[model samples]
Target: MKKLILSLTLAASVVASPALSQTVRIGTEGAYAPYNYVNDNGELAGYEIDLGNAMCAEAKLTCEFVTNEWDSIIPNLIAGNYDMIMAGMSITEDRKKTIAFSDEYYPAEPSRFMATAGAKFDFTALKGLKIGVQGATMHAAYAEENLAAGNTILSFETFDQAVADLAAGNIDLFLADGDPLNNVAEASKGAMVAVGEGIRIGDGMAVGLRQKDTDLAATLNKALTSLKKKGVVDKLIKVYFKDGPFYSN
Candidate 1:
């Protein structure tokens, strides 16, 4: 909750030397599907996981993933818990004040609102609706700023909780990144659907790093550029996101 309590100055002085020889610990929230998630085999698997592996290989750096709660992901990074964050975190200016970011791996797409199938609501006149969002997320900030004045914005700890609340009719709608929302809606047999035009917020998804980790950031950015040129980023996008290849020209 206290995001900026630790001063950037302290972070710089205390941050661990940008991991080079040691196995770089990449922290991720393994609960966000398609981005990073624990699969049925209890192994970390997802688009981010796959892409991270590719990036590390391209950078010629050894890296391993460690899962952390979303709300504390950045703080833990500042605390030197991990060297990088590849948790589908969007690159926002607000967040940039706290940490640096790599080049956009997942381009700025759009966020969507999910509701029960055929749920009718006016996009322009949105009112009297119970909107659910995971707390401490861009989607939460977006809903609070854009929708809370007219609607009841419910905050949950995780998107899955918000989805559960939507299924139970506790919330009229749920807002999130389009990928997982699409994944859920498609498998819902018309139980859920996306409403309104997509809303673009934040820059895009990128690797989160401590402000001091410029070398690691540069390494990842270079690796991401190479992968994009090789069509690897596009390939992963096609494999994980139906509407992607977002970073492609």
Candidate 2:
């Protein structure tokens, strides 16, 4: 009888271990400053990184972040390389077809055109000039649809590269998030200035999860809502954006 009980206990432990050991792996573009950039020590740090750790602590789950490139973030998540994507990915109807999103965590920030001071042109007045955008981004899609059919469209793998090309006179304009463009503008020292009013691509960013994982999404939303109610989210934003390098750089 003792042998029989021991065997049953061992079987139960084997059956329950996987669920108990599950960890949430998050994919992020560790290059987007003030969002999820990598620090000098090679650790991911930013508003998203801080928020991700907060969510994990609230949900009582172990969390890890993997640096991922922007273009293939979703595909790699779908491939099971990670359980969630915490990059500042906009929640669009088109992206919803493949993956589910948690409730938005940030306010909608628009994308605008930026160019060197002397070369800045009215976006509406650009009869035929080049526009640079990061490849596979919603900015690229918006520019393609709204601009003239023959307008020069230059695509780069990273925003920094596109900014470099624009500064070098290889491209006439660049479309990117307002915050990052703010950084570029400062770096340009009066050379780069944001043009025309920006366009809202979608609501704020959200965490992406595989379809049918509605349970995790529900947990995340609840935890996030609780965190916001507790003022943790606001506090984090203030700490990082208010007096940090985000404003200066």
Choose the strongest candidate by lDDT. 1
Kindly give the number of clashing pairs for every candidate.
Answer: 0, 0
For candidate 2, lDDT tens digit of each residue in 1-249? 999999999999989877885888999989887888989998889989999999999998889899889999999999999999988788888789899999877656888789888774655567688889998777887878877476888889988899889889899888888777987797789988888887787667789999988999999999999998887887777765564222111
Model 2 clash pairs?
none
For residues 157-181, what per-residue lDDT tens digits would candidate 1 score against the true structure?
8778899999999999899998899
**Model 2, runs deviating above 4 Å:** 1-21, 243-249
lDDT of each: 0.90, 0.84
Compute each candidate's TM-score over C-alphas. 0.89, 0.87
User: Each candidate: RMSD to true structure?
Assistant: 10.4, 5.6
Q: Give the per-residue Cα lDDT of candidate 1 at 80.
A: 97
Model 1: colliding residue pairs: none
True lDDT of residue 168, candidate 1:
95
| Candidate 1 worst ten-residue window by lDDT | 13-22
**Maximum-TM-score candidate:** 1
